[model samples]
Target chain A: MVNVLIDGLKERISNAIKINQSIGIILPASNYPDLVQALFERINSTPEEAWVYVTVTKPCDNILSQFEFLKDSKNIKFVDCISRAAGINKANDNCIFVESPTMLEKIGLEIINIFKEVDENVKKYLVIDSLTNLIIYNDPDIVTEFFYHIINRTRTKNIHTISLAIEEEELDKYLTRLIYLNDKILKVRDSFI
Target chain B: MPITELSKNELCDTGIEELDVMLGGGIPTGSTVLVVGSSGSGKTTLCMQYLINGAKKGERGVFFTITEPLFKLTKNMEGFEFYDKKLIESGMVNLIDLRIISERLGLDTEKYTVEDASALLDILRDIADELNVKRLVIDSITALCYRLQTPEMIRDFIFKLGSSLAAMKCTTLLTSEVPPRKFQYSQYGIEEFISDGIMFLGDIERKGDLIRTFQLVKMRGAAHSRTKSAMSISTKNGVELAPLLKSRE
Candidate 1:
């Protein structure tokens, strides 16, 4: 049977892909992997949109290895904020690594720089792998405020954003603000594998 | 100044594509660049590649070895594809062991005065002029600077030699090192000041992996990135680069 949650996200993405569009995804703990896969598959098929994936939970290598197809995709870039701090000092050519997740400002600059670098004709998408991971490393209030600016900033550049949050992670304070900043909220309730 | 004005000064490419990108095309012609690194951080490999690349461009080059002999250096170079025997045999690239030069000059290795340093500089300048080379590398300027024994003499000698080489249009790379845990680019903290450019090859110890890194710390008269990149040297690739990952706790 087709996954209802996956179908829901795919259906919602069409309208959410417009300029200034921001979709906040709230995922169930066990269904995180399936929903992200579904989301990227939708993105991968869309030829005009180039993705800039910002990961705070995992390094770029881990993500690229898990999503092996991404290795061949030149349409995507990564902003990994984890690897060297974990004692792994390597990075792929397509990915840019921020020194630490704590370096929030640097992360912001790198994200903007990547967006600036992507082809101008291609539509841009900024996907925060998960925002809760950032709250764990930073103060909730500040991360929310900073992301508020990120959403607005990217919107002006004709870029859409999809910020994910895991319900398994109890970051109630920040999640509430995340919802307010987003134009639409999505709940991925796909049954956990 | 007119908006259309541009510099016509010549530039010397390092032949390392990524490095040349970081250097804003290339180092200015007749510049002195310091290649500082800790031991085993691929300083020699980088310098060797630079000279070999120059030779491929038909611009003759010379390498003055201060830390090792000519024979051993060539033996190590054999492992890298950049090491071309034809260039060395044809005198397109010359490797001169500094120890032999010292022996010829009759200067005491342990103690070298400012006058002795001047004499050494004159001899090197003569050799560089004689060869009519476009590129020159002094592997481990620290070892040679140690002989000078004082900051003033080292500074004086570097300045004099750099000025003289500039006149002859010989782009130079001088190797030096920094101790572990210390931030200074050079051993004596003075070589960095005199050199026209500073490229530091550093290593980070993480989880038993010695991660080599490259940073173009200073490149005068050039637009360069301040970001650090992960670096590696291999027999097939010579020197390769990748993005440096973020650190973890």
Candidate 2:
């Protein structure tokens, strides 16, 4: 098994997780799919840790398809808020399907419920796939408030969270606000090599 | 609480046949439907027509005016051919003036607690029960949200209101003011999520002129046409919908 923390583009992220520090990642949208794969690969390396992946932009099946190697992993669960909004009703085990991404209250409640159901002995990590899609569907202030609540809740439970957003030059005020609340903000460049 | 569930065949007429056709028959019974649009997009007129049509069919209707006064709403509806004061006089159609109550409460408009919202819902429930109201319309829930603080509070109020209405088996039409800009369908963006169905009204620029258009974004349990239909409003007919501009051309 490769040590994701040893070196390369994801080394910073792997190092932060090792230190139990929550970080926010800002990267280009073009590299989002690849980054997700690499991030999950790092999670797969730790069999003792449980993960709750909250997908806002892409459907759960689409994200799961990209990481076929981790499909049968029992440590990972998904909170899908995209498929139902797109009118797709396919179901999967260990998955919670929300009506829409704009339902922030429902999404928060589902995350809490999932955390409760997981074994207390297992270390938990919460990953919000992307904040860019959330901003498109909700008011900026509302999305920021949701992040505040989620970040606080995860901290109390000793769960580390890594939120992702696309790098935009025009600069989004809300993204800036989220970065302020995070422990650290890591920018991933286009060329890992 | 779970929202009221309705089968495919269980439908309620929206009063306008063309609009109903666009909705794939009509809105499902006991559903909370959000009518979203910017100013002057006829969101209020469509809601009025729905209530008036229901009253005409012997279905008791109630209109809760949150933004506009009841007298002003009645006066404006007088221009429509379907306007009937006798229905209101006979108690078949009731208009509850919430603006007065909202003002009298003197609560902080910017920061209201969940209890304040619950008190408001209690008043509505009492009125709904006393009149056996089957059809309900809240003119501009956007105004109501403005009186609350956080998105969580706003969503909680809606969830509670929707649950109570569902238990009463009342079909509701909630009018929302769409904010200016792209992808903004409602004031807080939570309205569309909590609603069982969404109907968006907007102006489409065509041939160097603006044309009113109606689109069904989503309906939870029913199959609806996803096309944007050309629409118009007049005193004679409250709302009239035509085929899509592309198909008509």
lDDT of 1 by residue, B95-189 (tens): 99877887888988667888887888888888989999999999888888888877788888777866776677789999997776456788877
Fraction of native contacts, model 2: 0.00
List model 2 lDDT by residue over B128-167, tens digit each. Answer: 8888988999988898888887889988987887788777
Off by over 4 Å in 1: A18-31, A43-128, A134-163, A167-193, B1-8, B11-28, B34-65, B68-123, B130-132, B148-156, B180-185, B196-249
Query: Candidate 1, residues A144-170: lDDT per residue as tens digits?
Result: 766877887887887888888987546
DockQ for each of the predicted structures, in order? 0.04, 0.01
Per-residue C-alpha lDDT of model 2 across residues A1-193, encoded as one tens digit per residue = 2233224546777877767558888887776766776778777887788899999978888877877867888888899988988998987886788767766655666677678878888888989977877777766776787788789888998888999988666546778777668888887765544
Residue A69 accuracy (lDDT) in model 1: 80
In angstroms, how far off is A41's CA in candidate 1? 3.3
* Native-to-model Cα distance after best TM-score fit, residue B227 in candidate 1, in Å: 11
After superposition, candidate 2 runs with Cα above 4 Å error: A1-193, B1-9, B103-111, B247-249
